[model samples]
Target: MISKYPQLFEFIEALLPDNFSQSQVGMSGATTNPRLVAQAVLESPHQWSDYLTSLSGRLTEAERARRLYDQVIVEGARQLHPLWISSRRTLGWLSAQIEGGEDMDERALVARGLQLARLAPNVMIKVPGSEQGYRAIEQLVAKGCSINNTFCFSVSQAAACLKAIHDGRLRAQLQGVSTERARYVISFMIGRLGAQEEFARQASQRRLCLTAADRRWAEILVYQAIQALLRRRPTPARLLLCSLKIDTDVQGREHCWHLQRTGADCTLYTLTPQIIEFLIRSQQQGRPVVPANGWVQVPKRVLNRLMAIPYFNQAYFEGDLAPADFASQPAFITASNDAREGTQRLSAFVQQTGDGAARPVIPPASDAPMEHWS
Candidate 1:
C-alpha cells in the first residue's frame, strides 16, 4: 500500500533532526544539561553502568557527576563529528554546560568554558546568558572558541551575544588567526512564552486572555525581528530556535509549519525526542502539513498589542532587559526556580551514588590573545 502521507521521518530529517543525516540540510545539534543526563541514566541504567564503574574509585560525589556529564557530551560529540566536518565546520556541534552552581563566577566560567571546548573538536561550550555569562562568552569567542549562549529569553540578550561574537571574531582576525571555524548560536526559548501567556489567562479568568496562538505569533515576530537585524550586519552567529513546547493542536501545527517555511539561512531548530515523535505521529495521521512559502506577516494590530506588554517590549526592543530582569517576570522566575530545583535534585542524586574523586581543576586562562584552546 502506497502511503498517501509524506515520509514524516524524511520531512523532519530535512528540517534538521538533532541526530540525523540530511546532506542537503545543515544537521542541527543537541544541547544537554543535568536533567537530560539524569533522564537518560534512568532510561538505560545498564548502558551507563560502565561509565559509573569507571568513576567508582576515582572521583568524589560531585567529581563523579561531572565526569559522567563529560562522558555523555564527548559521546554525543563523536556521533555528530561527521556532520561537523561535512558542514565545513558550520554545524554538528554539541553543547555542554558549565556544571557549577548558578552563582558561579565569571573567571570560573571562562576557565570552565575553555576546558569544555577542549573535550572534543565538535564541542561548543554552553554558557548561561547572564551578565557574567556574556563576559565569559566575549573572552572565549575572542580566543576563537565557539559558544552556545543558552537561557536567552529576550532580544537584548540575543543582541548582546551577537555583538560579543562580532567583537571576538575581530580580535581573532587581528591576531592573524582565521575565524572561519568559530561558530556562535543564540538560543531563543519559545514554549516558555506560551506557558506564560496561558498562565496569565488563567490567573485573570480569561480577562487578560492571550491564547497560545497569540504567544506563538509573538515568538515568530521576535525571531523575524532578530533575523532582520542580523541581515543588516551579518555575523558568524546564528539564531537557534529552541525550548519548543509541543502543541498538537491545529494552531500549534500551523505554527510549526510556518516556521519550517521561513527558510531562514543559518538557523537551526533543536527539538526534543518527544517533540520529534509528536511531529511524526501528526504527519502520519494525515494532518495537513503546509510548508510556508515565506515569513508570516504578523498584523500591525497584533504587533502593537504584543508590544504593550512590558516584558514583550523589553524582549523585542532590547531595552533594559538585563539578566537580572528575569527575576521580575513571572515566566522567567518560574523557569529559574525550576532549573535551580532540578540542579539541586541532580546534585543530591550524585552525592548519594558518586565516589569521592577530586573535582577536575580548570586550568587558568592562557596569555595568548587568539590561540585556540585545543
Candidate 2:
C-alpha cells in the first residue's frame, strides 16, 4: 500500500530491535527519547545490564544516568545503521531528543544537540519549537546536524522552524560545510493538538458540543494550512506528523484520519506500534485509502465553531501566536511537561538502580511490547 504512495515515508516510533524489525518492514526510520530509553531498559534489562554494571562506581548517579541514556540512543542508531547506509543516509534517521523544557537555554540545547549528533551520523536531534529552540535548531543545523523539530503544533511555529532550518542550511553552505545528508523535519503533533485540555475547556465554556470528528479537524486543518504555507516557499525541510489518532465513523469503519486526509509530497508519518498494526489490519481487510493528493474540505460551520476556541484559533492561523508566546501555549506546556516527566523517570530509574554490582532483576516477559513514554 505504501508503495502506491512514493512520497509518503513511514517511520516506526520505537527503539528495541525486535519491535523495530517487526514494524520496520516498510519503515524508513525510528525515534527515541529518555522515556523510551528507560522503558527499553526496564523491558529488556539484559540488553543494558552489562553496561549498567560496567559503569564505574566512582561516577555520580546523574553522570551514570547520562551515560546510560546516550548508550541507549547510540544502540538505537546502530540498529538502524544498515538502513541508513542502504538508503545512503536519505532514510533511517533515528530522532534522539535532548532534555526538554519550555524555558531551556539555547546554548544548552545546542550543546546537547551537538553531543547527540556526534553519537551517530543518522541521529537527528529532536529540538523543541520554542523561541530559544529556534536559535538552537539553527546553530545545530548550521553545524551540519540533522534536526527533527518536535513539540510543534501551530502554523507560526512550523514557519519559524522552517525559516531557521533554511537559514542554517544556507549558513552551512556559506561555510563550505557539507549538508548533503542533513535532513530537517518539523513535527506537527496532531493528536496532542486536538486532545489538549484547554481546547475542551474553551469549547465547554462557549457551550459548544464538539464531536470527535469536529475535534479531529482542528489538527487536520492546521496541518493542511501548514502544507499550503510550505508549498509557497519550498525549503530543505519536510513535515512529520506524529501523535495521530485512529477514529471510527458513525458506520463503525475505522480510520486513521491523518492518513485518510493526508496530502502533499515529502510528508513523513511516524507511526506508533498500534497505528502500524492498525494499518496492516486495515490493508488486509481491503479498506480503501485516500491517495497522496487527497484534500479534506473543512465545512465553514465546523471551522467557525472551532475558531471560537482561542486555542484552536491560535493553532490554525499562522500569525495568531508569536514565538515568544509559544512556550505559554497549552499544547506546548503539555508536551514539555510530559517530556520533563519522561526524563525524570529515566533519571530516577538510573539513580535508584545504579547501586553497586547488584544486577537489577529483569521482570517477567509480558505479551505486550513497550509503548511510548508519552
Highest-scoring model, lDDT: 2
Report lDDT per candidate. 0.64, 0.77
As for candidate 2, its clashing pairs are none
Write down the TM-score of every candidate: 0.80, 0.87
Residue-wise lDDT of candidate 1 within 264-317, one digit each (tens)? 545666656444544556677676443355677787877766765665666677
lDDT of 2 by residue, 1-374 (tens): 34543332232223223444333345678776655666677676656666767888898877887888888888878877877787677767789988763557999999888989999887899998899999999889889999999989899998999889889888999999888888888888888888877888899999999788888888889999888888888887888888867887789989888877885555788777667657656655667454357677889999989989888889888899999998888888888887776677666667656643433334334212223311
Superpose all Cα atoms of candidate 2 onto the true structure and report the RMSD in Å to 1 decimal: 5.4
Q: What RMSD value applies to candidate 1?
A: 7.9
